[model samples]
Target: MTSVSRYMSYRGYQFPMLKYWSPSLGVTMLGVVGAILFLAMTLGPKPYYWPTDASYGSSPPIATRAGWMALALLPFVLGLSVKANMISVLTSIPHEKLQIFHHWTSYAMFLLALIHTFPFIIYHIDKGDMVKQWKTSLVYWTGIGAIIPQAYLTIMSLPFIRNRFYEFFKATHMIAAVVFIVFFFLHCDFRLSSWDYFIASGIIYFLCLSFSQVRTYLMHGIHTATLELLPSGLARVSVPTVIKWTPGQHVFVRFLTPDLHLLTAHPFTISSVYRDPDQAGKAPELAFYIKPRRGVTARLAALAAKQTGITKKILIEGPYGGVSTHHMSQFDTILVIAGGSGGGFSLAMVDEALRVSGLHTGEDESGQESRRRLQVVFSTRDTPMADWYIDEIESRLSQSTTLPGSDNGFETSVSVHITSKPDLTRSTSTLDSEKGTAGKLPPTDITTTGSFSLNIYRNARPDIPGLVARTVAMAHANPMPNGKKQRIGVLVCGPASMLHDTRNAAALAQKRTFGGEIEELYLHSESFA
Candidate 1:
């Protein structure tokens, strides 16, 4: 599909305000439900049983059909579980993007398994052979064993439980999945086509797993990572390597330290843009800004606190899930919204904006009347984090201006909303030292540097809807030189509340595109918390 059609399909609606699924997802789900219903109606037991006088067996057909349907879903569940898989390769959808479908498919399979289980019990109990079957039949034993772990996997994967006990969940989820799959394969007991489904699932999972392991160990390999604790209570991990990645992509980093996450790999968004070493004459670095919550992060933070700069051996698995650079470059305006540790996400986008605008390339402007605009809206409660963010922005803007053939008309603006009171008792010197400042925090005073402007708001939250509306309004007010309507790209990375507000705002703005007020408005959001 074309990008425009894809964007429209994926765009969300505000009505039924709590609904999170896009039009595309809703339609896909509807199709899945419809297919399930059709299958159940067509293949379900006609009389629910055959008479003892008849030639056919007495067991209900619904149980066998449900079991087959559940078996057919195994390959899909396994395919979606892997980061590197044929589904993602064929569909051009990231593994992370397929996560929702994976979850739903697993739920469907679990439901089918339950459906498959109870019918056998009900039928055998009515025939007065249920207790005998349980005691004697291997099929009953294997089926029960499979369902028990399947139940654990399903229940523990619920958002609240999974999020609260992530480390435990992650460890046990794999073990349970293995046990369930093994028992399920045994439960089939050489049934025609049942083994085929298991074989397909196993092949899909193994190939994906092998590819990922090969990529991680051979292609990417191990690298040293410097971990520094930022004043905002975030661990800043910097790994200099020959590997290159696009803006907004994330990597799964396995820290090879016993006290830290020795076995498990944690995902973190890459905070810096990749520059080709051959072109730049230096190895590019992958940077990650991580907020400490629990488990691995908390341990990393504790280590970072004791030592300002610590080094560890790490292996990175991917450069996955980012907006296409070609797609992003088509926009006339770029608006980025971020909150807290989402500052890192915003920085990578800003870097890409500068690169796409030819600021990094030092290319001469094409002499258009209107400039390409890049606007950033950040909300945070940490004073030090706000300072650090401003410093990073200032450094980038300063570098852009110094580059040869920089565009004079390129406009950039930043609005930082600090949602908490600044601690007056904290030593300014300590803060300055951490940020490499001149023994003082950055002034709260509004500053305009050439084409760049910065605004700081103290003890207040950002007006998300207002910001989005104003941006669209400004685009409408200023027509492009070529007489084409403006195309805007809106990227947001923040908390769920922030994402919800931004999504609604963008949805409202998208209506203007239909009215000819704009050409297109594309929104991409990532939840940070």
Candidate 2:
């Protein structure tokens, strides 16, 4: 199918506002040029290129222009690749979006690198000294070395090859990065106009690396990870560290063991909020619900299944990437859709919303109206995984009584959908009352508390578009407590298909004005891969 048709089909309706905010090829190209101009302005235009003699148009001014442009863009490329990018931090743009800019900027730099190289060679050839320069100039050789590795790295970065051979790709990518920097510096040889860019890039990269190393050492030096293997290829890795993290954030973990090496650090969502009991000045604890995909995860799962008692050292990198603060408290209705192990992130979002709701009491003409309604829809192939999450939901709800007037708290609902074959004895065949369709369904309302409920269904997957539509309608039905318009936030962390469906559904919902009340829908997607 065509990409537009697939997008429209998933969207269910067109939403110009959401569509316009997406990244564009044209915009990226413009940004590339803008960035170059911004840097060039800093370097003050002079006679950037001057010929040694009158013939051949004074040595092709491109030699100097191209060299300076390449230098100016180097810092941007380096900074964007780092997790704690200064530009991203300052601009409040998510690192993921910065990564898109990073990719395009790299392409621009590659073009500049070509421009920087061939023009110098051609200018020298026009002077009839190309072979002599090549034979004697260390700068020439170093530039050649830098360009060759960079070109090789760029070619190997093709999606098919990178995904298929990730380990080799990672190793070579790092090596090539180091090689590029070393030769790039030597080739420039402290040229005054461009030295600042190289120095800035080096400083930024050094700080990022140093901070990561120091943070890992301080956080995990005294920590321990206890792994419990769960049903359906899920393993729970629990680490006692005292660092607090926002909901939906993730960390890179390196497990040091005979089976697992330091080279295998992988990112995983912190499935739960940090719990700090304030006991003996210890740090907060965190847990990860890991699915063994391949490589490091598979090896770790196997080791955990064996139940060895030896203490294993670990390194924890960060609590990186989270939902923006602007999107956190404004939403009146929050829908979290997760598939399989992606529940790790969704459940934490649910917990955060509930916690926030308890802290803030929304008051209006009608006193004390609960402003947040949180819905969790988790789909998995195995009943056991669903059962585990069901238990977690009940446990969290029971703990909510600690809040003042705790009996009446936020409105939270959970739905666990088992899409594969089901246990016939436990699940009764019923029709979906909301959809008015006949299907093999479980009880619509399996369990309920004062304002919390858990629904379980069998032999079906969630209709992403239908659920989003119904929820938006319900949210719009209630007027906002203050004069503000009602807002809905849809967050999905799952397989690509689930993320796509949830995103498109959100895009469609955001377009509706809801009688000029501006019922807004925003979608946040988290993918561990």
lDDT of each: 0.80, 0.71
- For candidate 2, list the clashing residue pairs, or say none: 51-58, 242-283, 242-284
- lDDT (tens digit, per residue) of candidate 2 on 177-275: 889888888888887767888878889988877777788886446467888777546888888776778888888788776567566566788887755
lDDT of 2 at 139: 85
TM-scores for all candidates? Answer: 0.90, 0.79
The candidate scoring highest on lDDT is 1
Residue range 153-176, candidate 1, lDDT tens digits = 988986667888999998688899
Q: Which stretch of 10 consecutive residues in model 2 shows the poorest summed lDDT?
A: 431-440
User: lDDT, candidate 2, residue 336?
Assistant: 90
- The Cα error of candidate 1 at residue 5, in Å, is 5.3
Stretches of candidate 1 above 4 Å error?
A: 1-45, 51-55, 359-370, 403-405, 422-449
Off by over 4 Å in 2: 1-59, 119-133, 219-222, 279-283, 308-311, 324-329, 361-365, 382-384, 398-408, 421-451, 457-459, 480-484, 513-515, 518-520
